[model samples]
Target chain A: MKSLFFPVLLAALLAGCSGTPSKVASIEDRSVTATETKFVADKPLVETMGKPPDATSTSSSLPLPAAGRSGVAVETRGLVAPSTDVMGLAEAKAAEAAAKAADTGATAKSGGVQDAAILPYSGGMNQADMKDPASLLSKRRVQFDYDSAAIRDEFHAMLEAHAKYMKTNSSARAILQGNTDERGSREYNLALGQRRAESVFKALNLLGVPEGQMEAVSMGEEKPLSEGHDEAAWQQNRRTEILYQGE
Target chain B: MTIEIVGGATNRIPIAILPFLVAPELASGTSDPALVVAGDLGRSGYFKLLDTSTVSGLPADPESLPLAPWKALGADAVVVGQIKPQGSERVEVRFWLFDPVRQTRLSALSYTTTRAGLRGVAHRISDAVHQALLGEPGAYGGRIAYIVKHHGHYELQVADADSQNAVTVTSSPEPLISPAWSPDGRRLAYVSFEDKKPVVYVQNLADGYRRAVAKFRGSNSAPAWSPDGRRLAVALSKDETSQIYSLDLLTGDATRLTQGGALDTEPEFSPDGLWLYFTSDRGGSPQIYRESLSTGKVNRVTFEGNYNVSPALSPDGRTLAFIHRRDSQFHVAVMDLNNHQLQVLTDSTQDESPSFAGNGRVLLYATMVQGRGVLATVSIDGKIRQRLSQGGDLREPAWGR
Candidate 1:
């Protein structure tokens, strides 16, 4: 009985030890997986996290069970490993510990420990959140209608999340690339694309993002996301993509 | 490049271009001058080429030629030429034009040039023939600059007026568009996206030295050279939504030429530098508008259509060409600047970038045919048209001398 108990405890400790890195690794892999799953299986996740994840959001306080912690390890296998695979894994474990502490209602202890772990990462949590599947930053593109630069209603929440991130992190810079469908004059389309990107730039500025941290430019109708000449393809081509500096 | 002539003039001149006699040694080094001249006149839509292949022998000169047979063959004018080696590197080409109906010598000329310049010499001869017959300058001696997209790479190409002898001026993975030639024809101002943003660049065609002229805070594009070539009018969004600004090339200072909240772009200068015509949506929809440089007076140019953009003025400043949309189809249309009479010049559904030839008798533009971009030219009168296509997608054609 002593031998079996020792092995079980060691296994539990080992699972706990390995679980942290796996979670970090999963967060690093989220950028690719999230984008791939976005078109199909991630609609529900988007709907659930449609609003910015606030301090009172329960999704941030949910504790991962032992089985779910181990399941993260299995999910990391098929992903394209990033350069900071080990560090990401370690940071993820810290995040998981903080989440567990919060679940136990130890807010003060969890806050201190989370800050301490995140200080060594230097905006690592923020970057991970950007790549998080449930984060609004993951949805980078804002679609536009034909010959219109008005931002759609569905993207306000996502834009707000990005605006909040930029406001909080002053060093973060973004380039707003605007595009247009292959219609009308190319020079005119270029102006139209610039208008689209400026619309987003103005929206972010109004939401408290500094103008110096953002740039607006036009790609014109030269770079089309879809090659078709029909309306459906044109719809996809008209958009603005928000890109951050240094990943 | 492939050429397709569409439509013809009502009264075409009947001309015969006979094969040129070549010396034994010069035969291998020279291109057939008669063939080049025949092509120029044939595609001009003003002349109808009569067959001269069945003729007996090449004429030595006007003294030895017989106009009786050409007259009997129903040829109104006859052209005969010969090529002979002049020096180690140069060749002498001589040609004579005879009036078959009048049974008299109309004109004669001789040119000495390198073997490589033989095509240019032939084009000049065609120009001479055209001027002697129609009393107007020919557009064959001009060059054209356009953009070509192949295998996801964009290239700026400079070619002859006939779309031959194309030389790639610049190639980049990023896009390059809106090529505008300077008044001197030695430099080209265009928009390039190599730095991940649209920046206007002016490049010298001779040495290929380029510089970013309008690299402002936001997008800088739609560069139009002033009549004096001292400045460029560009559209920038640094201050507000895309507005027109005049940028001085020497000092790099930009003066806001246009104001207000509407989007204004595609700025073009009139030949006299008196007015600046551009596309603006301040009137609710996109339309062509002109602003006086001396006075800030503004006038809407296109009133019949809600969508009219990309305004290009003729060299004489009497005609304004633009892209007009009708029933969801875009076509190249021209308006008499004086009379305000508008006429659509093309049948293609997707046409853009209409530029006038040096003579102002033809307009060079880009249109989509079967989902592929091709360069096309239509006469000012809308009686003649030609399509030029190649392996890659061609667009943004600017004709210059």
Candidate 2:
């Protein structure tokens, strides 16, 4: 566990040095910057750092506002465990000092390492959480089967995360842009894509996202994620993307 | 553009079109009208162009030409024309069609137009010859609207029937698809994704003035004009998942035409304005269905395959063309409204967006040729076929009057 924890600590230190907000100041900014650099280079830096596993559990354990919130949070934890690993802090004290030093040298920072230590129990999201790889809000794409608008079971956790974020952030707005593979008529596919987007919209609404905060739209088969004319490409093309406004 | 004639009628009329004598002053500005006429006729698959290479001199007029030589060359009909400068910027084009065997003139016509209008004049002559011989109006003098994708941009282009004199109506970094022409051929309605969502826009062809006719909350697409040109039937998803709605052009009021949980789109109006046919998946699969404008009654039209969509009705409202999928390969098919008999018109695997020509004798559609999109036309009887290919990927062809 110590062997695995060092890289994540080093990554957080490097990410803090790169002028990202201190992890103590914002857990959201540190994780987002770490993943953004991971896509460019430094692949091994945060490979073992999974999502914050206890976030959903702690949110569910709180005083429940809605009847469906607890059930959804539990299901989300189940679906999010296997595919994504939670960031484990084996050496929390040593890593926190290093992150503070890097953050101070990089920029004027506030909310020292003590704030980062308690973020896992907060289950709160700001604008930076949308880009954080550890946040369920970062999983924006929801895929569907061919000729289907039914949301798959695997995306339940991601949807719940977004729903919680929307409920917490009242001023936020989202646009659901749906897409499809190039198999059928262009107009028909447009309708199909609309159906998929509406399905996502309805799901979010049922989870308490307001109607005024969301809009559903279709890209049809015109905008394809894969250009190949095969099933593998088709699977990737049939998806709905959750886009936040002013982000 | 390159044209390939796949199959043709066996008893094609053997006709020879002699080189038209052009005035020296007008020669530099205009193309050879005879070549244009020959190209229009030959690609149509109804007439066989006889060789005119060995002919000695260009005929000044049909009266000065000898029919004996053309008859000996196995030509059944002969065409002769002459272009003369009528004024400073105008030229007079005259053509005479004669039957070599009967030794009599079939028809003669003259048109005086500006030098820039010579191509239109050539197409009109082809139409006149086609009418004189086949007793039906030719579609060569019409325009075709389609989408071309090249250099990472999409352009909506309107061109002549022979794919010449093309003008881009709109170009964008995003996609533009499903171009539908109005009944009067004065405007075009198509779907554009410039705003990160599909919205229907109608643009005037002459002045390029465009308006977003269906910029609703959700996806707005599949714009089909009514025969009277007063309204457009579009598929919108503002209230539900893609239901048909009629938008009044004058008042911008949209009335819902279809209702259900299932998806319904690709609205097309009948020529008589009595029915609105669209694609619906209410029966568990995509199929063509029509709703009565007066009664609002719905009935299924196609029951053949699991997928039949993008219905394009003929001018006479007697035939319906759509994309039908079989064994995972999409093909264009036509259905007779009276008998409900279906006939698949194409053999290509990836055919789509079938639009009938102005004459209703041929259907133009887009298909994949070795992973590239190209436009193709086939006769109503599934006999003759012609492929029209250009440099970029072309699709969504709508032939206008």
Candidate 3:
């Protein structure tokens, strides 16, 4: 009983059916699968790296598996719970904006990317030369705002590098698909998804990549990345997929 | 350009709308003179359109005009417009509205637009005319909400009157459809299958707080709230038949308003709360039937539309709007309650879930576009038209009371 008390309390805390620190903490620690199921959208942050995001499939299922079992753990942490029947998406643009400002402020105060990096396990391709697809895809997903279709300030450096690469690679024809979660009406969601795709498209265009090289489309709430009915799954669904039609 | 024609109410000065001229370049995309004229006028609900077909009332030419016989027509106003082709896809149009009574030009305006935007330009003219005559706003810009079903899932959407803005409100693998709004414009009640069973939920618009309102054991759906915001009338199927029942929110008491094996759903209260109008197949084909609150007398209102599911009353208490199928497509149509006259507001499409805008000037219904569901609105007069954007498939958009 003593061993499990802390974990149970933590799971309830994260789930927050009751709004308390201990309760949310209990929700956080409970059985990885049985928490309230959040329908996951089709696109994820990883897909945003190379293409625009499609929002349709994400809200369909919760925390569904990605293709080929990519070791991506959907972190629901404090976002959503399972017991709630209807769902929505994050209005996370404001927080992402604040985070970027803090990053800049931290850079001015404490020095380099070492102090500015929040995720201990993730450091994006900030110094990759233009045209490297691997580094480009890594930067767009990690540093974006919630419910924001716009690529982030932290992402601009990465996007510039990616844009330069795409401009140089004349054979590359890219399709930027935008997406969103199941929080809004499908029409607004699709438009929002398109906006996200367009944002990424604009970033690539700024890199001097010709508009002809890239196209943007929106698929609002049609697919899903994870198949659980909890927050962990929904987080995995809110993303854009960049289809790299390679030469 | 703004025009002010103010006069005392007693004398009631007669006014006329000069036929607006479009440069030949701008007129290419337009089909009929009436489409541009009526799209602006009827949507506003402020026009007293006169038939000037016999009158030789004409505007001054930016081009050739045959003079004479202008005095015989009783028109007290005239307008002349000029056109210049800007490019293959663009046109520059100039128009002037004049008061023939005062013998002075009321408005002169010039604008440029894409060839595709000519309809919008004409609507702009209508807006100017409305501001000049009645001092009220025009309805060429507002949109509507409706419903559509795809793969058994229902979705609510917002769109222009012309069937654009095809957004999906909620799409579920298990079907989240049948959207209706609260009278206050802040909440929506919809049917969902989250429990893997049918139930209706009331969702707050500001916060998305959803809670089940009717979750009876067997089947509880088709919820319609009264105008006073007190009772919720719902249809629950029990023992192989669906019947209408009213639930008192405060008392938790359920009152059965309808009985029998025939489906009695889609109950909407008249503005006065004296009558309840609903759709029933009790008379064989689906049609609107009204039941009096005082007498409990039921009377069938429609005899035309073979398939009419959703019915919305006009805000004026004069018309009943519903979907009528003709030639394989369902179009939104309005019937005069007294004369039993049917006039189709939308044509050549599958339109359903008719809801009156707040003023009762127009109707909103859902249709399909390229197999995707969309919301569209049409004026009650069947004149003005506009289409919104496209999303996924939307279904059953009910405007708030």
Candidate 4:
């Protein structure tokens, strides 16, 4: 009982000094598969920290095998925790474990190339560049039929490209501005616009992209791209424009 | 351009309005009360106003004037008034409605008001004259609340029935839509996108004190005032999909009315408060539906068109005005509840947001004129149309009280 009392007191002191410190420290001492469940439980804490920084710095320091395993750990620590002492300690410990796992695990052989593949396109692509016709991201609009939000087969390639980019680049954020034609009530059109945006959001989520990276907003029929009252203009007005942050 | 149509209908009753004579003490300002009355009567589309400038020797006193001249001018009725100084800043207007055919005084009204309220008094006199002759309720003194999008700003404006005295109630950089007036005409419930999300706000017109009534997650929009004004029927997406919900203004508690995975919105209350009308896609396409308050049984209201939305019932609860799509063109249509007779009311291809007047005689709606949103009104008989385009791109008009 005397031996347990000192360790228990030390643990309580550690928890008191930092909120949810034990929750992070326990993940560092566990295996990758075992820690996944714990990571899931601690996701809310990570999300509460807001958007995590780009994983670019984390992957650069650690070698292939360790970074592969530690990639998951780095997400849980760096994104979950902030600049607190406990977060720094957890991030360092996870890096060390990832390095050790890379040295022992056989799958660590191709980890370096995989980490490079996950890095976002950092070359001259900014908000203005997104509007450039030459840029692949310029084709960001998803048009819908009258009173319908279902993405046609023609837009699958464009939507899939966006989904792939968002999945690989977690730090990037985009806003989907849904619009409708001037036919129905303004309030009903607002809901229809939301449904269109949510349809795109669902598509991105199905591709493994997180919902935090995308915000769905409906502009309804207030902002119309085409002022014509004919069917041709209505078709153009019924669309969703994908605008990235700072764009 | 502001469209003005007066007294040209073949069946209209011819009326004459004499220039109101002002006493020397209060005759400083050039306030034409008789002209205002003529304009009001002309807009009603029920009266044929005789040209008053053509008549000679018009007397302000009804007892002193001879009705032979007005009868020669083809006027069934002639209205004459005198404005006298009531106080330092107030004026008293006494008007007499004379039946030219009978050569007898029909009615008389004595109104005391400030100089600023001269138009208001004139409108009241017009209402009295209309009631005495037409045997119908007049909307001369009522008000209308509408939203105007100008210079990238959304402004909520309240104006008198004749499009005079327009007061900007509120202005915001974001979009403001769905302006619904309370039954008493003292409050307006509307949806604002100020927070980058749709939220319903109830504002007191007297003091401009506004409070957000619906700010739940997802969206809180399309606020419709109940007949009693104690509750608001709103559309909320808090449950992951848009659904109709009733919020008690007194208790601040919201009760869900419709349960479905489809979108339900644009709620309006029946005149008797027995049913709540709303737009829903539960039948695979958007259409108007109403649910009985006591029985909780829902019934589809519009079956003729493939798409019908934004249902606004008439004041007498005999007609339902909504946006109906015919051959890909959206137009305002009214269906008589008693006979189930649906009549298309507008020729515009993009007519939306239909609102009924205080009297069930006319309706105000939004339509596109030269690619700009403008306000238009039509009598329920599908005749007598007028377009008001002075304001820039105005929409979502609600006539009340």
Candidate 5:
């Protein structure tokens, strides 16, 4: 009778433990679940929560249950077993708690300071490939003498490379973006950038690049690479950016 | 521009043009002196022509340059010329300009032109006389500034009045809107949204100096300078109304000029300093309006286009050049305030900003070509147009005197 009574009590306790949710398993609805997506998926740590016992819902199931509920966190406080596995489980639970606390803390104060829009570059091309002088110079940027649109001779190598790339790669397209330094009026700059981009486009088309593969755009003086008040910065800003569209 | 006169007729520079130098063979049958004279003087823009009938009693020769009769005819100067065929496909042209007020020859010159170049000789002589009377160089070698945009971003640029030497001045990382120049032409005041909000910045051309001028709450855009350079008239939202307000550069105090819920922008001061010309959507689509300083009365100036902006008031306050959207593209157009005549300048390019030179003969505008913004200019007559393709493609050029 004593052994039967102990077994019956254990069964009841186990049933109750499987009914409640774990403390760390606070799953909110509408939050995206694990998936392959276009944007960055929910931060990596979001799905590290353990599955709950007897909870079939994949969308919103708690990790652990209370003592009165099924699949609650392992209740070592009242457990008769003094095994090391239980102790290891307890350490894991503690570590997860600490990690959650730290994550929340870091997120709360991540205010925007470096707020200037960084150039949006998410293509397959990496910085190393771009660092090669040939590749770097191959970028469709042309420099002009002050107050003149006549193409200079120095950009020949770069433009020729771009033309070659365009001729060889049928699927690749390039957008030439004309830019200017802070010198004239906004409207004037916009028009000037357009003129510069058009000149480059015509040059490319004349040099064997397909007319249909290249498009010209004028950003005017709005996009500057260097943020200085000096002439060097101005020179750098006075450039045309050749953007690649899916090679 | 506000031109206030005691009797309601403003002051004007009285002037005249010389007769067109026609070959003796061309004018062999006719002795009409008026037709010859009108062509030369009208092109100069320095003279208000007096009718040959008004000076009906004046002598035809230079010695008989009847001073009393010319004065009665409102003639401030007289021009006499001789054109004879040189037969080398050329003609011998001799001309002299006389100041009727002083009764003496102010200047004289001679030129030999090929038969086909006779008109060219006439224009050059007209330009010379125009320069002499105006004391300032004629508008023969000047430029205009205006605005232009491609897919994104605005460019304020400068180009020759004939649309040559188009150069970009301010290329921003964001959209640039209005561009106005200081009276001295050293700095350009324009609106750029670099901080993600419309802010006015004055950029110095001499030393790449750029700094925020006004960052008021809401929009601090549409900056126009007073003729004296002491104040900047801009459209602000601090009053919860997009009204015209003048900001004191030294003290940074903004003074409201209009009080209403109507959205008012594009404030340009009349040359006389007594009125402000701006655009308001109060009645409907954007139209140019003038608000009197002394009387606080508002009057509409533009009626043809549903959309018009970037008004460039001629130095004499007689003409207003602005942009109007038509057929899905904007083109620069000028309005004769007295006659209310409107003329579109560009064909298909999106002309964004337009400004006039001090002489009021040249206009600078910005337009897009080949996807980049470029500055262009045209004479009000719509003839003698050229394009300026300066490096770093530009837009929104403001021409100072």
Candidate 6:
């Protein structure tokens, strides 16, 4: 009876010891396990926080010069492991982060001041291309309602694209020629045409295009695209044409 | 082409104009003076010019006037003239007006002029005949300043009121508009677009010497001479929007006369030199308005239409002529200042730049004919209408007082 009682007591003690880490384990194993466990627990916390635990921590302390030079900052907080595979995992993580950073970075860099650096033709574009009907730059004419200079919503995107192109090419210059239908007095039509040109000019200005790069002029009713005395012709006549320099 | 009367011939006074005789030596080379006289009288719409073909041989001397033939042709009055060559470059004209019914010699006048002045001489005779019969002054001898556009070339032309002897004052490849005559009719102030922008110039009619009177940064147009000819009422856009400004023709000083956002232009001074009549859109749409020169007080003069522009007060200050827009058509209208009754004198659409003749009986303006502009005139009473188109574009006609 004494021998059976001692074996049961030993089995109960071993089960209890295995259920929790023992304080008598080696420091390395304990520390690594503690850290690994913390990581598992903190991952959901980091995700819920929607932020890296330490934005500048992991990459800054690494001995990898290749990582620093890459400029591909990893937004996710990487887990630190006291194992031989950490270097390879960190590099691989960094590369993955870089790819993501590049994808997002591409979106923001477009139309940005930094974009001026990589534009075609020495940060400028061939002016002749602006006149090509198939080119996006050729879609510069902005139409308006009768006696109105207000820009329509449909033209917003086209103007934005133009604004972006103009922003990227600082050396380019453009002329906005405003026209009108043959209905009002010649002098009044001239003033109205000017208002239309100026309206486009102001929109471009708001989109980051410089004022010096563009000039507004009114051709009045003198130059009509269609001579028919009808609404359809008038609509076609009342438009502002964008012309680039030396094109 | 002959002058075809458009309207206004009922109850017209009867007058007979005989064929003017030239010296036998120069008859074949000289232009007939009777044609001009007949045209001038017929255009008035107040005279019934008799057919001279029905009459027998005309008398050369006023003493031997053939009253029986003229009276037999239902003539109330008769005009006979003789043209004699004064020299190689000049001619002497002797004209006589007769009252055939009363059988009396009314007046006789003689003028010595160059061959080119034959038209002027005929017009002067026509004026005399008009005054004698109608007991009122006539603008037959006066000059009309206008712009003629041919193949993209603009010519500032001056012609006899009867549309004869048209002389190009200055020809430009650019547009020239709004010709205003000096009080003396010796110079013309006009807007020229030589520099790709509107600029006002005053040119001497005799020598064609021109000087830019207003060349401000933006636009300088609608130049009107004051009564005294010392100042010009100009519409300038140097201060953002168009505004009326009195520019001293001698001192180069411009005084702002209006302060608003609406366009103020086409300034014309009242004949009395008291008010500056102009067109302003301050009342929401363009209307005729007058500003007192002394008090600087502004008053609205036109309330009949939403669009009235190009105001020109008659020499007597009794009538106001302007372009009135009605039902999308612009017509020349005249308002009697005393009765406040407005009468549209033109029946054509797109009539603009109405100007009054010195007699205030005829109003000359520009009208469109199948996309081309032509000069047209109407009697203030809307009785007589005539279009003077020589197959060329014409615009902005101003008759000298």
> Residue B297 of model 3: what lDDT?
87
Candidates by lDDT, descending order: 2, 1, 4, 6, 5, 3
lDDT of 4 by residue, A5-95 (tens): 6456546544543456443333321211111112221122223211223344343321222343222211111111000111222353454
- Which tens-of-lDDT digit does each residue in B36-100 have in candidate 2? 89999999999999999876766555557889888999998999987776434345677788898
Sort by DockQ, top down from the best? 2, 1, 4, 3, 5, 6
- Interface root-mean-square deviation (Å) of every model: 28.2, 28.4, 22.3, 29.8, 36.2, 42.5
lDDT for each residue of candidate 2 in A68-171, tens digit (9 for 90 to 100): 22211100000000011111123323433454322111111111111100001123336787788998988999999987889999999999999999999987
For candidate 5, write residues B179-281 as lDDT tens digits.
Answer: 7778876567877655434567776543334567777644466789898888899876555435678888888888899877666777899888888998776
Q: Is the docking of candidate 1 incorrect, acceptable, medium or high quality?
A: incorrect
* Candidate 4 C-alpha lDDT tens digits along B96-160: 88998898988876665555567777877888888899897777877777876766666776666
Better of 3 and 4 by TM-score: 4
Residue-level error in angstroms, candidate 1, position A202:
1.0
lDDT of 1 at B370: 93
Candidate 1 deviant stretches above 4 angstroms: A1-126, B62-64
**CA lDDT, every prediction?**
0.77, 0.77, 0.51, 0.72, 0.57, 0.69
Residue A108 in candidate 6, Cα distance off native in Å: 75
Summarize candidate 6's per-residue lDDT along B1-401 as a digit string, tens digits.
12456887688988888788788755643678888888888877888878778667765565578697788788988888787654343456777788888899887776655554576677778888888888887778787878776655566666667775555555555567788999988678987655444677887654345678887755577899999889898877667457889999899999998778777888889999998888887898888898888999999989997988878899999899988899999898999988878988777888878889888888888888788788888888888888887646788899994
Candidate 4 ranges with C-alpha deviation above 4 Å: A1-140, A153-175, A209-215, A228-232, A242-247, B6-8, B53-55, B58-60
lDDT of 1 at B174: 72
Q: 5 or 6, which is superior by TM-score?
A: 6
Q: Least accurate stretch of 10 residues (summed lDDT) in model 2 chain A?
A: A74-83
TM-score of chain B in each prediction: 0.96, 0.97, 0.63, 0.96, 0.62, 0.94
Write the number of the candidate with greater lDDT, choosing between 1 and 4: 1
Candidate 6 residue-wise lDDT at B153:
58
